[model samples]
Structure formats: structure tokens, C-alpha cells
Target: MAGYSRWIKPEVYPLLAPVGAVVGLMAMQLVRNVYTNPEVRVTKQNRAAGVLENFEEGERYSQHFVRRFVRGKRPEVMPNINKFFSDPE
Candidate 1:
């Protein structure tokens, strides 16, 4: 490593060093924008909408699965038990 370092000219290194530093700084700013900028906010909103759509799709899938596998078993019907317990006299 030291041998390779010695081959670089001192004058040329200083000029190239700042160019590399500037490039690294700009790359950090680009990464920061992905986490905190409006573009990211919009992307998050779109993702949330997609998740809600998927949830509805999943509900449908579950209903289909139960109907196919349960063999004539239906979802239990509510007995309107609340009506009997309420005071009405």
C-alpha cells in the first residue's frame, strides 16, 4: 500500500482529493433526500394506498379459501342476542 501511495505525485493528489471529497458530499445529500423530502412523502402515500388495496384483496382470498375448504360450513349468524337483553317492557 505504501509503495502505491508513493507513486502518486504530491501535486496531483491535492487536486484530485478535493474532487473526490465533493463527490462524496453530494452523494450524502442525495441519500438524505430519499428519507426526508417531498418525493419520499409521496412515495410513502402511494405505498400506504397499495397496502390498503392488498388488505381488501386478502379478505376476499380468505373468504374464498374458507368456502372451498370448509365444505358447507357457513359463517355463524348473529342471533340478535342484544335485542333479548335490552330493556323494552
Candidate 2:
């Protein structure tokens, strides 16, 4: 332990101390930006809205197809051809 401390004192600590402080401050700033930045919040909200809009569009298209073809009854055979190639195991 003493030898490790001695090795750290003059060689490692002086070089690492300031770098560590700067890195710590940078990490704190990054966390603060993620938590408090308005631009980041708006971008996140826009991305979420885009995703939700895409999902709703897909749902509406599927519903329209189901209403047209399947009506109120379930299909006897699966409509998708790709299901045959899928691994059952």
C-alpha cells in the first residue's frame, strides 16, 4: 500500500488530478445539459411525436385493410406468404 501510494504521489497524481477535475466538471455539465436544455427537450419531443405519428399511420392502414378483406371474421389461412419461410423452432 505504501509503495503504491509512493508511486502515485509524484508521477500519477499531479498528472491525473487536474485532468480528473476537468473530466468531472465536463460530466457534470453534460448531465446538466441533458436535464435542463430546452433544445434537447424539444428535439426529444419532436422525435417522439414522429414515432407516434408513424405508428398511428401504420395502425390505420392495417385497420383499413382488415375492414376491407377480413371484415368481422378471422381468416382460415394466414395472408402473409413469408410466414412459411419463418423458423418454427
RMSD of 1: 22.3
Which candidate achieves the best TM-score against the true structure? 2
Write down the worst ten-residue block by lDDT for model 1. 35-44
**CA lDDT of each prediction against the hidden true structure:** 0.61, 0.62
lDDT, candidate 1, 1-89, per-residue tens: 68966877677877887999999999977775665443343565565654243456455544664477776754545435655566455
Candidate 2 segments whose C-alpha is farther than 4 A from its true place = 1-9, 42-46, 49-89
Per-residue accuracy of model 2 over 8-33 as CA lDDT, tens digit each:
76667677979999999999878856
RMSD (Cα, Å) of candidate 2? 17.0
Judged by lDDT, which candidate is best? 2
